[model samples]
Target: MDDPAAPRWPARATAGLCVVLLAWNTLVVPALPGRPASAVAANVAATGVLLAGARWSGLTWAELGLARRRLPAGARWGGACAALVLAAYGVALAVPALRPLLADARAGGLDGPAVAVRALVRVPLGTVLWEEVAFRGVLLAAACRLLPLRAAVALSCAVFGLWHVRPALGGLAANDLAGGPVATGAAVLLTVLWTAVAGLLFAWLRLRSGSLLAPVLLHLATNSLGVLAAAAATRGG
Candidate 1:
């Protein structure tokens, strides 16, 4: 029999820690010198802490829908849809009329092999995992518990968009091609809109798969293709 007076300490502690970590990474690290890596590390650490909390609370990875199980059908369909969206974006950017609007869509200048290495080693196994944990696993899940599904998804997307604002604005301001306040502002606005759409799509994938792994893989694939496309554009290949 369970103890009548036993407190739900583990759950409370886990929830509290998650909040603190999110606040620290979101509000504090952006102002630091080494921003991206520090923020990413903090996010990874927060995930680890949350996992520990889950263990203490008698929750398994499977209970959190974090188990690594293959969903071949979902993977195939999601991959196709993601590729289609990316191709549409690519085609739009390639059009002469849209070139001015997509000035920020330049490639990364990485070689083909380097792009492959970065996608496999740097993005999927690193950034995607850390980002998915922070955005989908922790933030979205917590928001869903407190708010309606739509509200949670919207708020999460807003937060995700805001998180990119600093870097996007800074890059635009620093770019020689992006001149004047009007141009910079337009670039930033476009970036924000794009990120919000991507955020919503990722969230939808998470919900549809009923597992974080699917979204993580999808995110990795999308980013990898983006890098490759960027490289190709830079080389005029």
Candidate 2:
């Protein structure tokens, strides 16, 4: 008989906590008097609560891939992969058919320098870390525990795509130009596909490296290159 007392994977608990926190943020926090401050506080509090839960569930920072000590070899490999992805993206942008799409993404008020700063600070350190923790470390890991590898990967990718649906719908709703809805929808569709592809890649990296650190590095590098490319394009324009 299977040992019923076997400890549940820490990832499962963390994913559940993330869902609850997301709900709380969406529902209760927004109703507070100081909405902005409440939102920030709620997020911070959620992080703290999740971290504590992780510890209690026998999860270390390493499990969540937050333990960054050695930085030479890993950084080198991650950088190379990022460069390759950027080159591919550059080729896509150079194609006349795709140029307009690239231009539209760039046309939003955020310029290259601003993008660079956001990638370096907000994206890599904040968004990437938090997102990886929630998606790869928590959700993917939990899925793997409960399902077969392929199923886990597919489910995780679906979840990741669904998470972005709201923003995509909002973009479609706000589209004003003649081809705005088409463009926005296309962009959103492409983004969803790209994120799914990325999820698979990141999953493979995590499994191969036996650490979340590798995937996190890969994600950071990808975001950094994207920011740099946007900046370069804006400057050229």
Candidate 3:
């Protein structure tokens, strides 16, 4: 529960920032001309901006799920989720055919050290940090105030799904999918759909653990290990 002194944000204003955050992540970031690696800097900055915006939107630390007391619970849940995902990735790598499915063209040409850096550093800081903090942290917290729990989750997750459209564009060839406008469109749509489903689970982590760190660590493991899985595929795993 929030402290009595915590300021309650107006539904309208909090909701407005939710919309802006969604659009900014989906529409604005992808359109900026730069290499994917360079986006890490921008996303790092964006994380701070989102937190500041959340506070200004009148969300308290507990509302944003960053309260220090909740960290232990969050870590347990997040760690368990991360372990499961890592095991699944291990299984996928063990299967010859499934390796192709794990291939990510973005990680295609990196050397050993480069891939290590990406999995250990880039994916965590660049992709997962801002995303969990944005969709699950600020947006979800703000949304819950204005809508039912399920509806608030749906709003955040749906947009979170669409947020991958641009990144998936570059990944189509990685899966060895057919090359055509229609095929690419379908692939992108499938990515969005699955990611939206994944978003629901991430939301559950945040709500269940009552801490943003839960989803953040889970997301970090997913994306970071994903980079390793992709590199393994590149090496004919």
Candidate 4:
């Protein structure tokens, strides 16, 4: 007979909480009034929720891949990821078909300096930290413990796809030259698919490096570069 008093993995509870948190961040928050502000609030809340849940489930920072000892290595890998993203954006700019994605539909008030400042602050603080911390750090770690590595990566990638649904849809609104609904839907699908692949890569980095810093840096660099690239492209770079 087995002793029923021993502590076991909280797989079911974690999964449920993950679903709720993901839904709130992706579905609910996007629809709320105040776009960028709501986005910031949603991300912060999601991080707090994930951290609280991790503690409740007896998970440590290391288990979450948040060990700070690997920061140096993570920074190096992050630089590589950023370089690759910029190279890809360079290609997109060269190709006319891809350039449409970088079209600047944003309101025109912010100039180069303002845009750079916003990207510097927003990318690392609001976009990168909470996302990499929650997705690659907390959710990926939790899924890995519950499932095989391959399965965990796939599931986490799927969850990551879910995370971008609102943003993918929102992109259509921010696009000045977006076509009809069908085209918008297809664009959203492609965005989700691409981000899913990116999520897999981030998860791989997190697992291989055994540090959340890798994903954090990669996430931050990619987003910051994106903001800068968009600004430049819109200004005819």
Per TM-score, the best of the predicted structures is 3
lDDT of 1 by residue, 1-237 (tens): 012232333345435644565466456666757744555565566568766764565544433446566355447656776777587658855775644443333235455666677666656544677667766666665555455678767866776666666657666654455678887788878887888888898888777776666677678767766666556554442
lDDT for residue 102 in candidate 2, whole number 0-100: 44
For residues 1-237, write the lDDT of model 2, one tens digit per residue: 012233456455536754664555345654767744454455555556666765666555554444564244445556667677777668856775654444334324476556655666656654566556666665665555555668767866766655555545544544443256677678778767877787888776665555566677788766666656555454455
- Angstrom error of the Cα, residue 139, model 3: value is 0.2
Q: lDDT of each structure?
A: 0.62, 0.59, 0.83, 0.73
Worst 10 residues of 1 by lDDT: 1-10
Clash count in backbone of candidate 3:
0
C-alpha TM-score for every candidate:
0.67, 0.66, 0.88, 0.82
C-alpha lDDT of residue 210 in model 1: 61
lDDT for model 2 comes to 0.59
Writing each residue's lDDT as its tens digit, candidate 3 over 73-116 gives 99999999999999999999999878888887667678889998
Which scores higher on lDDT, 1 or 2?
Answer: 1
Top-down lDDT ranking: 3, 4, 1, 2
Model 3: lDDT equals 0.83
Worst 10 residues of 2 by lDDT: 1-10
Candidate 3 residue-wise lDDT at 146: 69
